[model samples]
Target: MSPTTDADLSDFVFVRRNDGLPIEEIPFELVERKGVGHPDTMCDAIAERASRYYSQYCLEHFGRIAHHWFDKVMLFGGESDLDYGHGELVNPYTVLFAGKGAHRCGDTPIPLADILRRAAADVLSEVTTGFDADRHLVIDCRIVDHQGAGRGRSRYRPESHDDLVAIGDPSLVSNDCNLLHAFAPFSRLEQAVLRIERLINGPDFKARHRDTGWDVKVFGSRNGEDFSFIVNMPFLASDISSFDHYLSRKAECREEVVGLLRDTLGGDPAVLFNPTDRNGRPYLTALGSVADTGDVGAVGRGNRVTGLITPMRAMSIEAPAGKNPLDHTGKLYGVLAQQLARRLNEMTGKPVETHLFTSKEAPLDRPDQVVVRVHGLQDGGDEEQKIRAVVAEALANTAELTREIIVTGVTMW
Candidate 1:
């Protein structure tokens, strides 16, 4: 839906239906949430952190995040049995981290396998409730190198590779021509639900709501003034006793969430947790998440580039999470596209879609395509000139995009 923020529409294209209803005035809508426990998002977050931990390790020792590409990660969800408040995993996760990387710093082994496995354990613990990282799950971190315990091959044998050749490499550029966008003051409902999830998942929140697992997902929708949210969060069986007790705990969590949403959105919004489950059976996690059950997840299936799979708007399906933080356009341009969109919208007060495309090995700033689409923007108008100037300035400021991505961690989906 389009934004309702008041703006001068004199030079804008006022798009309206025959009924004269704005885009946000849809009578009905559908929104889905991919929980943090969901297989795909779990994989995405783990993979992202894998790169991040490695990047930090590299920067600390080698002065930069050396050549590591881990886009081939896979999450294998295991099976579990649950009745009421008790559940147990019969088969735990068979998570495999496979990909290419430079796993050495001048003969000093970087401990790639250890780092990736630690990354998995850290992420799994953070994303779930009562799951034991060392006992409840099986993790296999394999690097593509001729080393201790990796899978394939590293970049020309990590032992004797030219370190300086890999570092500050010009070929360390975007690998794909991508189109990314950002919401300038993002959608209100989006911000509200995300904030609510983080609030409920915080250590302070968990100290109170023990039944509320860390794997939280919030799906927000609006029908004009009526807003509602469907959250899919796994309830920890260790904290819950019976199905009735589980429901009661779930209700308490929902009530707390509803209060948060109501205050933020300034209206009463319906909040439901695990709405599709029956009374006798619900999403009760033996390990504090649905991943211990029959749910299978992949890398790119969870969130869009914006971190939420919002289908109603123009978005990139590129799984920016866990991709190479330095060179991959899927990660670098995800930030770039968002920056471009935000700046354009801030200057013009118009719904803008900023698209910048760059091929492999090309300069990140010198995009082959720099196209900005503004709603109601006329071609060759003075307003268009201002918009172009704004885009140019933003693009000029992106010389350090890669540095920012690796330093701050790639934050898109």
Candidate 2:
């Protein structure tokens, strides 16, 4: 049958079922309650620092043309899986980097492994005061051998043997304590998102984005269930009549999407939209969930007050634009960090610190169009109310700052 405006899209929607439970009844005590020194915290620090360093290095060396020479840098962080049955927690150490021209780092070989290891050690040392030297943290870097002995193809292959090197660890952690403790807060984020999705879309609404591919699965409470969402929106300039028509079309499409989502999973129906509309804006949304919640209650109930949702905006300025994209990204990130920290503190009635990162990628086709990635972090409490407030503030500030930047006519080419 031809797809109709009201036709259910459930067939296209994906579902993942498991014995895993939703975060609903999970006691709040199961979540870890530490502020810093958490594995996720450490990962955030490392990823931010590494991305910032890479961005700066590119700017200093390539100037306005840096984006043409850059690539993706994957930001990897988090702990190992926990073996609850065995009463052991395997604290997982991960290495994620992103950059442009990642496939062509075979020439002018850079010591990527060394850089990653150093970065990890520095991060660990900075986070862990008086860390036990006896507990040696093994940090290794190696190329991802995806092709099984030449039988498979590598996901990322350097164009020249002299390009940059790829580094990571193969030894996954194996432990007994609830490794979930290390990732409880993140789990809460997942729960909040899932609840919201189900409320607006339906219970069957599954996350459609992943690191490797576009796969859809229901939010679960088990290993490999952490959820994250990314929304990409575009602004357009059009007549009011056209804009109304566009909104109508968007609303119809959104309803169909949510209807299909509910049919697949049996969730409640709800819709979330930006309070303000943008002209010609295209949006992308991503979701992730955690599988375990060992200390959910201890940390705090997943209240909106303690949860936060923030968006980090990035723009690329091509060469000959009379500005450096890298420098501009750094400056913007700094501004975001400072502003977010102040705003979060005021909203939460608690002192807060913000983290920021800048990343660059080399243009494969357009040598002049440099791409800059900016990441920002804002702290929220463990309650739902607090989290929601933080997210609201962050989003408001981000939108304002983005508008200001565009109006100032700043360029980082």
Q: Give lDDT per model, in order.
A: 0.66, 0.29
**In candidate 1, what are the lDDT values of residues 185-279, reduced to their tens digit?**
35666677667767777778888876666567788888777888888777876667787787777788778888888788886888777776655
Clashing pairs in 1: 12-376, 13-376, 143-150, 144-153, 145-154
87-191: candidate 2 lDDT, tens digit per residue: 111332344433322222334334445555565567655433223222324453333323324321222343443222211111111111110000122334344
**275: Cα error in model 2, Å:** 40
Which regions of candidate 1 are displaced past 4 Å? 1-29, 79-91, 105-108, 145-172, 376-390, 393-399
Candidate 2, superposed: residue stretches over 4 Å from native: 1-34, 64-107, 130-135, 140-413
TM-score of candidate 1 against the unseen true structure: 0.81
Q: Candidate 2 at 322: error in angstroms?
A: 26
Q: What are the candidates' C-alpha RMSDs? A: 6.8, 24.6
